[model samples]
Every structure is written in structure tokens, then in C-alpha cells.
Target: MTFKPFAAPTALLALGACVGRQSVLDPAGRDANTLLTLFAVMLAGLIVLWLAVNGMMLFFNKISTRHYDESTARKLIVGGGIVLPTLVIAALLAWGLSIMPDQRAPGDGLRIKVTGEQWWWRVEYWPEGAATPIVAANEIRLPVDARTEFNLTSAYVIHSFWIPALGGKMDMFPGRETMISLEPTEAGTFRGQCAEFCGASHAQMAFDVVTLPQDDFDVWLAAEAAPAMATDGAQAQRGAEVFLAEGCGACHAVRGTEAVGQVGPDLTHVGSRKSLGAGVLEPTIANIADWIAHTDDLKPEVEMPAYTDMPEDDLMALATYLKGLK
Candidate 1:
């Protein structure tokens, strides 16, 4: 039996996944656009050089040896092989380096700090001229056409922060801060993940990134800054009681409620998020209940303890209550 190479088809499938979301090539930010342009230039240069070399090789193979001379050899060797490549490489290097510093966020822009933990992310925003920081988790929001600075660090192991639609990845190290900046030019929702493998759940450690217009972003920030909404329905009240009684409050916080635990993702506005469990599943009542009952099934090797012993009705009530948090 003959074996077929799977590389080409696999590559094609991966390329197909590059356009809709999490694609650096389909850039929505200034930095990603610059990088994409550079990549295109380099790829074009490579194709040109490959064609030129192959064409020359084919020509030489077909030519008679009698026309060859020392001078011709010297010209081809020294000029075509050495001088041209040297100048081309030097120019490309200079051009590439010059564009790198442009990725830095300008002096006047939004500042946010991201701390990567074991399988999750903690996000804090420092608004302009504000004394206190706005804390959130798992999702990030950006303003269109506004420069945003990210201060990255890790609470445990090293993790990489990356939003392919926005910019390049930067490592978050313990006790040291790394920075990167980007300005989104469009309004859309993108996906991001912990580019570094921190633990067993690394593949599931994802986040949603939403970019909006300036006025919309301001409104969102203001709403997120406020306290959590109160539960009204009797079922939601029962769920809240179950949430506290089940000891879920020790690791999560739903602002304005008894669930003021900081060890896990903030649930203050969890219901408003586009996805749940760090993008592992959709934000729905059933999924939330499943996550509570079997987090390891949805995301293997997660640190969250499963509530498999809880009754189905209680789980449903809890999920309903959490969903109403928005």
C-alpha cells in the first residue's frame, strides 16, 4: 500500500480557518495590519527569488557548455548571488525593524492589566483619570480607533497574551510585567486565548474580545463599573441561596451579592458574556448547569470542582440565577 502525505490537505484546512475569526491575516487593528503587510512582502520576495533561481537552473541545464566563461561565472556568482541578496536582505531588515516600534501604544490611550492564572485570566481596566480600577474576567473590550496598552503578568506560571486580530503575542511572566499595545480600527467580536501552555486546560483557556465605537465602549465601561443587578424572581432567589450554600462564593464574585470570591472568574456580569467557561461553551442555562455539574467534561483538567452531587433542579436554578446576573 502507498502512503499519502497529509500535510498539504491539513495546511489547506488550517488556512481555511484563518478568515472568520482569530486570524492575524484578516486584521482589524493597526499593528496586525502592519504585520500582515510585512508578511505579504516577505512571502512575495520569497516567491520571486524561488522562481528566478529555478528559471536560471533550467536555462543552464539546457544551454551548451561551450559558451561558458570565467568572467560570466564571476559575474553570476558575485553579482547575482552576493551583491543582490545582500542589498535586498539589508533593505528588508531595515524596513521590518522600522515598523516594529509602531506597535507601541502612544502616550495617551487606555491602560489595562491582565494577569494569567491557572486556566483563566483576570482583567483590570484603569480608566483615564480614575483612582480605582474596574475589574473583570475572561473577556476584553476595546474601543475602535483608540490605542490600548496591555500590561501583562502571570499569577502562577508563564502565559502568553494574544489577540490575533489586534496584534502580536507577549509573554506574561511571574513577577515581571510585559507590555504590548494595539489600536482596533473596526467594530467586531474576536477570539483570543492563552498562547502559552500554562497547564492541562491551556487549550480551553480562551477569551472573547469585542471592539466597539468610542461612545459604545464608554457606555459599556460605565455599566460594567456599576454594581451587579439584583435577583427578582423566586427561582433566581432560590438559585442565589444554592450558590451561597454550595460554597461557590469562596472563589467567585458577583458584585452586590454574597458571592465575593476572587479566586475564580468574576461573575458580576457573566450572563452578559458571549461565551462561558473561558470560551469552552456557549453562555446558556443548560451549558452553565452542565459546567457546574461536570466542568472537567467540558474542559478537561480544569481546577474547578464539579457539583455532580447537586440535584438537577438545584443545578437548573443555579444556572438560571447566574444567567440572570446580567
Candidate 2:
């Protein structure tokens, strides 16, 4: 009979772990699981304490007719209020602090750099014995069951990078570097977003995270490190002209080509990215056309200019060319 009141609330809390995509309750990595464990321990302790106090109060009220000595009340106050609370808090603090250092990356693990920008994420993979890091934007791919270190930074304003299912939130500040390491336990896809309020399109800034086997991850890194593919058809060649004529080269870059602008994300492998505009839309030709024609309509205050003035055929060619870069 006494346990009935806790049934519904406990059920709901247990069900919270099944939430898909971005739930902290559904932790998938070691670091996040450790946090979830700590939360559960604290919750159980508090609930037991609360029930004990309430039961004592009810017992006292019913025994009001009996002789109640001041010495008993003094003993109860000292034991419950001071000693009990101090011991519980000290134990909880010690457990939580022990989980902190477990999230650090190993000394020789793979390294990746993430730079937070106004409405996008600049991603780079540092492979073994490579002259330059493989660059991508708005997405990260990691090998499952292997430690991966992340060097987080920001170019413009302060931004917080977070993937709730994976681990903790870390701040990215200009001119300073912070680090967080994560090792996914299984192969799957997840979503990441900026936790800080940076600017007008702060809500729109997001990225995709993918985990794969070790062998698959190595193959992907090799492909990403290669030069951008040359256009294969006349239509694509013509589209390259449109990209240059629209002054897109002034801010964006495509590797192995003359379009070298460091201000925007690298489009060397744009066609293969899962989502566009920092995970706002699906990567498709029609969506690409819409994004190019109405850049500000989709993402307000973005630095990219609108290309509504472009000819429909030229726009199609440009879209096809960009899509083929994968």
C-alpha cells in the first residue's frame, strides 16, 4: 500500500531511457553512462530520506497524548539534520569526483579538431603521417570502441558543443582550446547541437555524428584525405563556371581546385554530407537548389548571399557539380 504512490513516477523515469536521438537518459557511451549512474544513486538516497522523515512526523503526531521528552527531540535533530546529511553529501561528492577523470582521452588515440563558427561546425581529421588534415564541415565520424580526442575551439564568439547521449558539454572559446574525449560503444548515428546562445541562428546550428567499425573508419579517412574529384561531364564543367562567377570562391573552398577561401566550410566533400546548412535540411538536389536561391530564407543572418538571380539551367548545373564532388 505504501509503495503505490511511487509506481507511476518510477515507471515514467524508467521509460525516459527509451527516448530516441538526443536523450541524456539514454546514454550510449562510458562517460554518459557514468553520469546516469551517479544521478540514480543520488535519487534513491533522497527518496529514502524523504520517506523516513515523513513517517517520523506522522508517528509523533499520533503519540501527542504520551509524554515526549525534549532529550529525544534533541537527539533526533542532531542525528538526522547534521550527521546524516553530512555523511550522505560527502559520499555522493566522492563518487561523482571519481567519475570525472575517466572521460579523458588516451595519450595516443586519434585526434580531431572542431571549430565552432556562427552557424556551422568546421571539422578536421588528423590522420597518421598526413601533410594536411582532412577537412569537412557540420558532421563527425568516429570509430566504435576506440578512444577519440577532440580539440575544441571557436573562431567568432563563445559556443558550447554538446552531444547529450555521448558525454558532457564543453565550451569553445576564441584563442583558447578545450578538450573532450568520447568512445562510442556501438555503430550508429546521432545528432549534435550548439548548447550556447551565440547569435540569431543559434538554434539552427547543428551537426550529425556517425560511428563505424575500425576498418570502415580507416577507409573513410583515406577517401576524405584524397583530392576532390574532377568534373566528369560538360554540364558539371559549366556549373563550375557558375560557382566562380557568383563569387562563391571568395568565402568557400573545394580541395584540389583554385577555389580557396578560408572563411567558410570546405566543400571538398559536400555531396556526401548527411545534411546541409549545418543539419537543417536533407542533402538533395532540390534542397540544394532551394538553399542556393534562398540562402537567407532558410537560415537568417547567414553570410552566404542569395543566388535567385542565377539562371535555372546554371543553377541546376551548379547543384549537379557540387553533388558530384562526393
The 10-residue segment of model 1 with minimum total lDDT is 101-110
TM-score for each of the candidates: 0.91, 0.91
The global C-alpha lDDT for each of the candidates, from Candidate 1 onward, is 0.87, 0.85
In the range 23-124, model 1's lDDT, one tens digit per residue, is 987999988999999998878777766676676666777764457688997887777667776777787789899899977656345799999988888999
Enumerate residue pairs that collide in model 1. 252-261
Please list the residue runs of candidate 2 whose C-alpha ends up more than 4 Å from where it truly belongs after superposition. 1-17, 62-67, 128-131
Candidate 2 C-alpha error for residue 147, in Å: 0.7
Best by TM-score: 1
Residue-level error in angstroms, candidate 1, position 62: 2.3
- Residues 120-155, model 2: lDDT tens digits: 999989865556788889999988888788899999
**What is candidate 2's local distance difference test score?**
0.85
